[model samples]
Target: MGNRGGILPAVGALALLAACSAPAPAPVAQTTTPASASAKPPTTGPSSDAPALGPGPGSQPPTTPQPPPPNSPAEVTSACPFLGVTESSATMGVVLDAYAVEEAKTTQQDATTYHCTYASRTGGRQLLDLFVTVVPGTGQIPSLVTAWTKDCKGPAKPIGGVAGTTRTCSLDGADSGDVMVLVVKKSHGQTRLAELYVRPFTDEVYAKLAQLLTDRL
Candidate 1:
C-alpha cells in the first residue's frame, strides 16, 4: 500500500425548486373615456407598475450547519485496526495483521486536537484504523494510543512492519486513546509521517516508508 496523498473534499448537494407560483399579476388599468372628448388618458398605473409587496414573511431562514458525512472506506482503511492501504495502490507495502477479533468497526480519537479517524474490520480477531490530523504550526502533536475495553480481549500489542523504504512501529496499545510518536533518526527530517500514527521501524519498513514519503510528500 503506497502512501497516498490527500484528496479534495466533495461538493455539497443542492436541491432548488422554482417557486410553484408567482404573485398575482398587477390589476390592469381600466380606461373610462367620457363621451365629451378632451378627457386626458390616465397616467401609467402607480408610476412603476411593479408590486408593492414586502419581503416574504420568513423567506429562506438560515440553514443549520450540517454534520459531516460518516467516514468513508478511504478514511476507515487509513485508520485501521490492523492494516491500511493507500487509495493510490494495493501493492502490500504495509501489511496489518489483526491479532484478535473478526473484522469490526471501532471509533478512536485524541483529546488534545482535532483529528479524523476511520476504522475497519481487516479479518478475524483483528481490526485496524487510521487517523489523519493537522497539527497547529506552533502546537504539539498528541501521543497516539491503542485502547480497548476490559471485556474486549485479544492481542492488543503493537507490531513492527516495513512499508516501502520507511520503517514503522505499529503498536497495539490502549483501546482508543493516545499513542507515542514513532520517529526514525537516519532520515534526519528528509522523511516524516504526515497526519498519521505508525509503528515498526525496521530497516526494510524504513526504506519503504521513506520512499512512500518521497512520492507522497
Candidate 2:
C-alpha cells in the first residue's frame, strides 16, 4: 500500500508539471474595420476653377447696330455741306460713310450752319463749314465780298452759279487754287440770301455747290 501511494503522487506531480510547461496560446489578433466607400467629405468654399456666372455689371451688350438702307435721299443732303459746290445738288457719288454731320448756330446773323466733318477711311480728316444768312435782295453781297477779299492775294472776280454771280479772292499764301475765299448770291425763286465762306484747300467743291442753287433767280 505505501509503494502504490508513492507511485500515485509521482503521476499527479508529472501531470501538473506537463500542464505548466505547455506553451500559452497566441493572444487573439485584433480586427480593424476600414472606412465606408459612400461617406461624404466636408465642404470648404468656392473652387478656384469655377466658370464665371455672367457678364460684368457695366458691360456693353454683344450686338451690332443695323445701318440705314441704301440710296437714302436724306443721306445726300446730309453730305452736301462738305461736298463741292457742283456736287451740292448731285444725287450720286455722295459717300455718307466718310462723314459725320452736326448742326449749330453760327456767329453771323444767328444763321443756321451745317458743320460736315469728314473722316476718310483711307486716312485723314477735314472740317467744312457752310453758313446760311438772309437778306432783302443781292444788296448784302458787295460788303460780304469785300470782307472776304481783304485777306485775299488773288483778285476778286465773278463767280457764277445756279444761284447767281458773286466773287472769290485767293488767300495771300494759298497754293494753286487748292483753297480760295469765295462768295455767292442767289434766290431760289425767293428773296432769302444764302451766303457761304470757304477757308482753304477746297475750291472745286465750293464752285460745284454754288452753281446748283437756283433754276430761276
Candidate 3:
C-alpha cells in the first residue's frame, strides 16, 4: 500500500510539469501600406490627343491674306495713249473722222492685242490699221520678231534711238501701194509688237510713228 501511494504522487507531478511546459499559440503578422506609395505619379506632359496650345502672350495675331494682281490687261475703250486719231490722221495725210478700238486675246500665243482702225467719215474707207500686242515676257521677243519678219526678204532694221526690231514690206499684187511695218519692243518684262498698215506708204511717216510707239512701251 505504501508503494502504490508513492507512484500516484509521482504521476500527478509529471502531469503538472507537462501542462506548464506546453507552447503558446503563434503571433499573427500585420501588413500596413503607406498612403503616398499607393498613389500614381503626377502627370508631367501633355496627352497624345490633347488640344494644341495657341500663341502665347504678346504674340502677333495672324495677318490677312492678300489677293494677287490681274494677269491680263484691263479692257481698253479709247485709242492707245501713244497713238490717237490726230496722230493717225497726220500719218495717213487724210482726214480720219471714224475711229474704233478692239481688244482681242490670242490663246495660242498667250497674247493680248489691241486693234485700232481709222477710216474716212464720208465713204468709210479704211485708211490705217494698227495692232499692238502685249506678251508676258521678254524671252519670246526675239522669236516673235523673227516670226513676224520672216517673209519680209531683208535683215531686221534697228530703229534709231529705240530698243527694238523693225521691218518694212511693200504689199504686191492687188494690195500694191500699201505698206506694212512691224516693230517689236520689250519693256518692264513685257514684249510689245506694234504692226501698222498704211496706204500710199512713206518711210518718214512710218519711222516717226514707230519711234513714238516704242518710246512709250
Candidate 1 structure quality by residue, lDDT tens digits, 1-217? 1011110011100000001112212222332421111111111111112222222353332222222232222222222222224421132254433221111111111111112222122312111122222111222211111111111134322224423222233223332322122221112222122223333233444344333333332
Candidate 3, 1-217: lDDT as tens digits: 0001110011110000000111111211212421111121111111123222222353334221121121223432222343666665676576665443332222122344444434333334455555565555676555565554433334545545444577666433233444556676666676666666555455676777676565554
Per-candidate local distance difference test: 0.22, 0.28, 0.41
Q: Candidate 3: give the clashing pairs.
A: none
| lDDT at position 50, candidate 2 | 26
Off by over 4 Å in 3: 1-79, 103-105, 151-163, 173-175
Q: Compose the digit string of candidate 2's lDDT tens values, residues 39-117.
A: 1111111111323222235333322222223222221112233334223324223432233222222212211122222
Off by over 4 Å in 1: 1-122, 125-128, 138-202, 213-217
Taking all chains together, the TM-score of candidate 2 against the true structure is 0.40
Candidates, ranked, lDDT = 3, 2, 1
Residue 73 in candidate 2 has what lDDT? 22
User: Could you list the CA RMSD of all candidates, in the order they appear?
Assistant: 28.1, 47.8, 49.3
TM-score of every candidate: 0.25, 0.40, 0.54
The window of 10 residues in a row where model 2 has the poorest summed lDDT is 12-21
